[model samples]
Target chain A: MDTILFLFSLFVLALFLGVELITKVPPTLHTPLMAGANAISGITIVGAILAAGADTSSTLVHALGFIAVTMATLNVVGGYLVTNRMLAMFKRKS
Target chain B: MNITIVNLAYLLAAVLFILGIKGLTRPKTAVRGNMLSATGMLIAVVVTLLDRSILTYDFIVAGLVVGGVIGAVMALKVKMTAMPQMVALLNGSGGGASLGLAAASYLQSLERADFGTGAIAVLAVFFVAVTVIIGAVTLTGSLVAFAKLQEIIPGKPLGFAGMRYLNGVLFLASLAGLAMLIANPGNTPLFWLTVAVAAVLGLTLVLPIGGADMPVVIALLNSYSGIAAAAAGFIMGNTVLIIAGSLVGTSGLILTKIMCVAMNRSLTNVLFGVMGEVG
Candidate 1:
């Protein structure tokens, strides 16, 4: 538990700093940053599905697990779509 | 019979999750992924309901209905610009649920001595307690992040030159506290203290992270919540929980790496870049 939380917190800090540093760099990297973050959110879909199988005794647990999975799927799907759309806006002329 | 049905549902759900991930890779198939994942979830719910031992199904049903209604309303109403805030809220809710479950299990164990003070039982309880604290911190800190992103709170990073050093010290302290708790089980005060400190650390650490960096933070917190849930599963000896937790942990880390590359930043730069000012 401690290991997971500590790693997660560390990741959050990494993200924070990454965003902070980007301002000093060129704007060309924004699309990539967004894409990367989108993938991170996608991980939740896997987690939700896994949680679905964790408990076999509670009806509520099963129901909640499914709900989480669905919600995460939406986030992942919508997130990627939005990222793609944003990238499209940045297309450069040949 | 119930176990068989539940396991089957889990199997179906796992397949759906895989399909959903595949669908999510491209814009054209994103909707399909959403549908597949939702279907998997539905299967899970139905199978769980087949279980005969759930004494509180009635209340659970009522709670489900209420939650469903509220969730639908939010889905229909939230603006795209506010999506990150919504994500933050959802992540916080997930963390809260994990914390609540861990606490409930701990209390249940204390009252019933269900496992009779065995070494495994003690380990289970400790894992649950630690998970609960970590989850609580994630929940509260994520909510605060949402507020900051929404401008309900300040978006600026907050700290001094030595603040990062202070955070490091606090982390070590939390680690020591956790070690002590493990050394002596049933230390409720120590458990709560560990939780309080961790929670503060989560907020302080996050507060300095700018809104521009929220996307990755959200992903990382989502991973934390998954882990907390996994630990709860450990206490209950739930196989699904462990699988799900590991999946998130791995994926979230991968995503974090991708984000670092996208920003042309190193992980160390991000972790220690808590400079006092931002434009």
Candidate 2:
């Protein structure tokens, strides 16, 4: 329980700090920063995957975990790719 | 099982969840919303761990240690440029966790001698299976949105000729899978196939959405995650989880609305809207 609490608080803190940073930082960096945070969220994905294999129930847990894994993976892929693409716009215009 | 204390805990958590969502309505008070929601989650987790059969101490300690360390590191080390990606990933994980819990609860039910042998039991299994499919698809789809935002791959929208037709087919297939599961939930293969189809549908749904509209996608996905959690809570008969998850689900939907305003776009513009305009 404490662990989940901690994780939850951590997420809140990240968002709090995120809003603050976005305000202070220039607009050019917005996409990249968001992408990075999205990647970190993958930790939860890992935890979920592990939980799937935990001692509770196998079939349901495994299935759920598989779904979570799939979702998190897509998030990582899509977020990073988009951030990079946005950053690419900063290249010197001819 | 005396449930007075647990019920009260859930009631309190639900109140906090409501407060948190109210707070999240505006940027100025968003932090308060986050704090309130976090508090609600804390209450929920503690109450869940209080179950007599949980064997709490060791696992609880380990969970805190590992989760705390990673969370701390993430909070301190990650730069702002990566915040959105992080949000996407974290949101994806939350969705996944909810899905996993639902699945675990179902599996436990199936293993029970009383439940593994009847038509009613099959209905229960079907609910669990359908929940898993929706939850899984939501999870994967959110991740894909995250990836598009971060530019790990092309951020350009990917669409095929007859894309709408394809999506339509997938939707129908998902529904069929649901019907099949409900009719014969004991068939594990059928359940698995449903999950697989749902996942592919998730992938398909997000594929054509361009990078520019990802914030909206993220918000929408957050709502989906919350709904999944709520379903899990129902399956497990966990009052706290249900309340907290519903709070998140509703709040996410509201947030998505605000985000659309910020972008000067409508929800329709966000989904099918982005496709009409090319990079």
Candidate 3:
């Protein structure tokens, strides 16, 4: 319970920091920001790694982990590359 | 090789993630910011790989290679105009990953026989349900959003007259399933039922939203993807996941608000009302 509470508090603190960090993004970059942030959402890849590599006999667990890792890798790699591409487009014009 | 060092690395990774998001505030630095975030993710992944609990490497390496190759191809080839749908697809996958992680973790816990009947059990089950439902919703919801944006399906509002009530029933049913799983902890079927209902609720919720409202919906789903990650972190007792996940969660919410204001769309209206129907 202490751990959950501690984590909850951390989540709340990060919430404030999240708002503080992204205050002045140009509207043109909103999509890019969304894209970049979406890539960060691929942080779930850490969880996926844990599940995929967990030493268990259950095929279901392995299958779910494999799918999670695959999907999250797509999310992470595709997301960052796309964001970079979009940002480059905006950068070239200016 | 010790746990403390691993945790310290995670802390450093979390800090990098924060700075990475901070970099997104400016156009000049946005690309660099994205790279920094990626570096942070690299750090996290490296640290996770070092953890003692993980024994098998075959599936992990294989999934990474396959996913990485396909993601690279899609990123290189997709037109800029299609970026939104692309982001939607990625966001959905992230959500799917979290939901998958939650389900797998639950099964692992069952195998370990560690889901005790104490308060810890209650909390663990709560996290599982949260991860499952939120992750499932974000998964299917983002997919529907992608379909609408990609023109694979009609972009118009897809709600029926009873759509609102159906959404309500589905939500309640998911909750009941959660309750049953909590009480009987061993009822895997009930647990799966909860997953299915939550997934259907995702489709139902996003169906009524038209293409015009997609920005808000996408932003909201992005937030949910982060939230699902954070919930998974709670289950795993991992700080880096919590911090990074909530960072995305908050950033996504900020983007959603910014989008609402920019599009001159009321957040609540687009978010709650059936889009094509004007009351």
The Cα error of candidate 3 at residue B179, in Å, is 2.2
Q: In candidate 2, what are the lDDT values of residues B1-279, reduced to their tens digit?
A: 246886787677666655654543434444454466456655655664455545324433444455445444554455656666566666666666555555555555555534444655554565476557767777688788778877886778887756767777877887887787666655667766777787777777777777777777776776666556555644544544444454455545555665666667678645442353333
Model 1 spans with C-alpha error above 4 angstroms: A1-94, B115-118, B269-273, B276-279
On TM-score, the candidate that comes out on top is 3
> Taking the tens digit of each residue's C-alpha lDDT, what string does model 3 give over A1-94?
7777898899899888887887877888888889888998899999899888888999999999899899999999999999999999999898
Interface RMSD after interface superposition, model 2: 10.2
Residue-by-residue lDDT tens digits, candidate 1, B1-279: 467767666666655645654444444554455466556655655565555555444444543455455555664566656766766766666665566555545544544546445565556656766676667766777787788888988777766667777778767777777777666656768866777777777777677777777666666676576667556656655444444454445445555556666655455534543643352
The CAPRI classification for model 3 reads as high
Instruction: Arrange candidates, best DockQ first.
Output: 3, 2, 1
Chain A alone, TM-score per model = 0.60, 0.60, 0.94
Deviation from native of the Cα of residue B277 in model 2, angstroms: 2.8
Question: Candidate 2, which segments miss by more than 4 Å at Cα?
Answer: A1-94, B55-68, B113-123, B269-276
Ranking by lDDT: 3, 1, 2
Candidate 2 TM-score versus the reference: 0.71
- Pick by DockQ: 1 or 2, better one: 2
Fnat for candidate 3 (0 to 1): 0.81
